[model samples]
Target: MLRLHDSAQGRVVDVVPRVEGRFSMYVCGPTVDNVPHIGHGRFTLAWDVLRRWLTFGGLDVTYVSNVTDIDDKIIAAAARAGRPEVEVAAEYEAMWWEAMAGLGVLRPDHAPHATAYIGQMVAMIEVLLAAGHAYRIDDGVYFDTSSVPDYGLLAGQPLDSLRAGTRVEPNDQKRSPLDFALWKAAKPDEPRWDAPFGAGRPGWHTECVAMSLELLGENFDLHSGGQDLKFPHHENERAQAVALGKGFSRYWVHNGWVEVEGVKMSSSLNNFTSLTDLLARADQRAYRLLLLRAHYRAPIEVTPETVADAERALERLDAVARRFRLEPLDESIPVRRSDHPEIEAAGDDVRAFVAAVDDDLDTPRAVALLYDLATKANALADGGDTEAGHAAAHLLAVLAGSLGLFLRGTDATLDAASSALASARDEARRRGDFAEADRLRDELVTLGFVVEDTAAGTRIRRA
Candidate 1:
C-alpha cells in the first residue's frame, strides 16, 4: 500500500482505497487561458508519477482531471484579442495537450470539460439553494461559508482566522468576506447559460466539485492539486460537498510550488517561465528527471544549470543501457519480484527502492537508489562478471521505468564525422597527448554529441 501527505489531515497517512484493489483520483487540470508554466508542469508530473506507480503496483487506477473551459481568465483573454471565449479556450487547450504530450504525460481516463457539465452544476447549485446552504445576491448565487462548520478544513485554519486574512472585495452585499460566488452573473456580450437564478456562468471553484462527484462519485480515493489551490479553491470545493450531505475526497494531496530565486513562479506574479520554451531548448526527459530528483513537496529551482546536470545524469543511464544491450521496460505491465529472477537476485536494492517510494512518494531517495544500482551494474560488467552485470542492469531499467523514466539502448546513429572524431580522441588519449585529446573531445561536443571515456573506448551519443 502507498502512503501520502493528506492536506486535510496535515500529515502523511495510508491511502486506503474506497474499493478493494481499485484507486480513483481527481487532479485539478489547467484553466486553459494561456500557455502552461513550470508550476503547471510540476503538478502534472507529480500526479502522473503517482498514477504510474500505483498501476505498476498492480492496482486499477481511474484518473480524472478536469479542464476549465469557462473561466474569468478565459473571458478576459478573449476580450483582449477580440475573439470568442470558446475559440480562445480551444486554442489554449490544444497547446496544453501538446505540451503534456511533449513531457510524456499520459492522458487522463476522463477529461471532463466545464462547458459540458453546466447542467449538472446548475442542478447542484439549485440543491444548495433549496437547502439554505447558498443565497442569491444581486451579482449572482453565492455559497455562504457560514453554512459549513468546518469550512476551512483544507486550508488548515479556523473560520475566524480565514475571514480576518481575506481581502475585502467590491461585493458589499456578500454576507461574509469568505463567501464565494457559486455562479457569476454574465456581463454584457459575455457567454451565458440560462439558469433559474439568472443568465450566468459557473464559478471557478464549482466545476471541480460537480465534475469530481459525477465522475468518481462520493469519497473518491484522492483529490490532488498544487499547494496554491489548498486555500479558498479546494476548501470551497469540499464545503459544497459537505453542505449537500455527501462525502468528498477521502484524501487531499498537494504538490509544492516551483520557485525561482526563492519566489514562487506564477502567472499572477509575472515570474513564471513557460514550459513550452523549456521543452524547446532542452531535452524533455531532463525536466522529468529534474522533478524526480527532488522531493515533490520541496520547492525546486529550475535553471539551465540544473537541467544540464539532469541531462548528464540521463547520459549515464543511457550508457549503461547501451553497454548491457538492455531494452526498455513497459510499465503498464505489472511487475512482481517473484516473476523476474533478476529482481529476486537484486532483492535488497529493489526493496530499498520500493520502501522509499511507498513512503509518501519520496522520489528523491528512490532516484538515488537507482543511481546506486547503475553504478553497481557498470562495475560488475567491468570486472568480468557478465551475467551479474546484466542482471543488475535489468533491475535498474525495471525500477526506473516504474517511475516513467525509460532508458534507450541506442541513440541516433553516430554520423561518420562524429565517429571519426571519437576514434581520433581515443588515439590521442592512447598516445598520452592530453591537450589534443581534450581538443577533439570538445569538437565532438560542439557537434551535438556527448563524449564519454569507457574501459572499451570512447562512447558518443547525442546530447
Candidate 2:
C-alpha cells in the first residue's frame, strides 16, 4: 500500500484504493488561457511520478485531469484579442499539451474539457438549487456555503473563521462573502449557454465536480493539484458533492509550489518562468530529475544554477550506463523487478528504493538512493567486479525508468562524421600519440559531444 499527504485531513495517510488492484484519480489541469509556467510543470510532473510509480507496482490506474477551456482568464484573453473564446481556448490548450509533451508528462486517461460537460454542470446546479443549497442572484446562482455543515474541511478552518478572514466582494447580493458563484450570468458580447436559470456560463469550480463524478464515479481514489487550489477551488468542489450527498474523492493530495527567490511562482506576480523557455535551454529530462530531488510537498527553486546541476547529475547516470554498456529502458513496456534476474540479484537496494517511494512518495530520498547506487556500480567496475557492477547498473536503470527518467547508454546512432572522429580518437590513443588524442578529443567536444576514455576505448554522447 502507498501513503500520501491528504490535504483535507491535514496529515499523511494511507491511500487505500476504493477498489482492489486498481486506482482512480482526478487532477485539476491548466486553464489554457496562456502558456504554462514552471508551476504548472511541477504539479503535472509530481502527479505523473505518482501515477507511474503505482503502475510500476502492478496497479491499474485511471487518471482524469480536466482542462478549463472556459474561464474568466480565457474570456478576458479572448475579449482583448477580439476573437471567439473557443478559438483562444483552443490555441492555448494546444500550447499546454506541447509543453507537457516536452516535459514527458503522460496524457491523462480521460481529459474532460469544461465546454464538453456544460450540460452536466448545469444539471448539478439545478439539483443544488432544488435542494435549497443554492440560490439565484442578479449576477448568477451562488452555492450557499452555509448549507454545507463542514464547509471548510479542506481548508482546515471553521466556517466562522473563514468568513471572518475572507475579503468582502462588492457583490452585496451574495448571502455571504464565502458564497461562490455556481453559474455566472452572461454579459454583452460574451459566450452564453442557455440554462433554465438564465443564459450564462458555468463557474470554474462546477466543472471538475461534474466531470470527476461522471467519469471516475463517486469516491475516486484521489483528487490532487497544486497547493494553491486547496482553498476555495477544491473546497468548493468538495462542498458541492457534500450538498448532493455523494461520496467525493477518498483522498485529497496537493503538491507544493514552484518558487523563485522564496516567492511562489505565478503569472499575477510576474515572476513566472516559461516552461517552453526552460526546455529550450536544458535537457528536458533534467526537469524531471530536479522535481524528483525535492519532495512533492516541499517548495522547489527553479534557477539556472539548479537546472544546470540536475543536468550534470544526469551525466553521472549516463557515465555509469556507458561503463557497463547498458541499454536504455523502454518505458512503454511495464517492467517488474521480480521478473528481472539482475534486479533480483540486487534485492536489498531495490527494496530500499520501493520503501522510500511508498512512504508518501518520498522521491528526494529515492533519488539519493539511486545516486548512491550509481556511484557503487562505477566503483565496483573499477575494482574488476564486472558481474556485480552490471547487476548494480541494471538496478539503477530499472529503478530510474520506473520514475520516468530513462538512462542512455552508448550512442550507436551517431552521424558518420562524429563516428569518424571517435574512431580516429581511439586510433590516436592506441599509438601513444598523446597530442593527437588530445586534439581529437577537443574536436569531438566542439562537435557537441561529451567524449570519455573507457576500457572499450572512447565513448561519446550528445552534450
Counted clashes in each candidate structure? 0, 0
Question: In model 1, where do residues sit more than 4 Å from their true spots?
Answer: 330-342, 413-446, 450-459
Location of the lowest summed lDDT over 10 successive residues in candidate 2: 331-340
Best by lDDT: 2
For model 1 the TM-score comes to 0.92
lDDT of each: 0.89, 0.91
For model 2, the superposed segments whose C-alpha errors exceed 4 Å read 332-342
lDDT of 2 by residue, 1-463 (tens): 6888989888889888999989999999999998899999999999999998888887899999999999899999999999999999999989899999898888899999999999999999999999999999998999999999999999999899998887766578888999999999999988899999999999999999999999999999999999889999999999999999999999999999889999888988989989999999998999999999999999999999999999999989987887888877775554554456667667689889999999999998999999999989988988999888888888999899888888877777689888888899899989999899999999999988888777778878887
Q: Residue 453 of candidate 2: its Cα lDDT?
A: 77
Error (Å) of candidate 2 at residue 251 is 0.4
- For model 1, what is the C-alpha lDDT against the true structure? 0.89
Q: What is the lDDT of residue 253 in candidate 2?
A: 94
Across 160-240, the per-residue lDDT of candidate 1 in tens digits comes to: 998888787747899998899999998899999999999999998999999999999998999999999999899999999
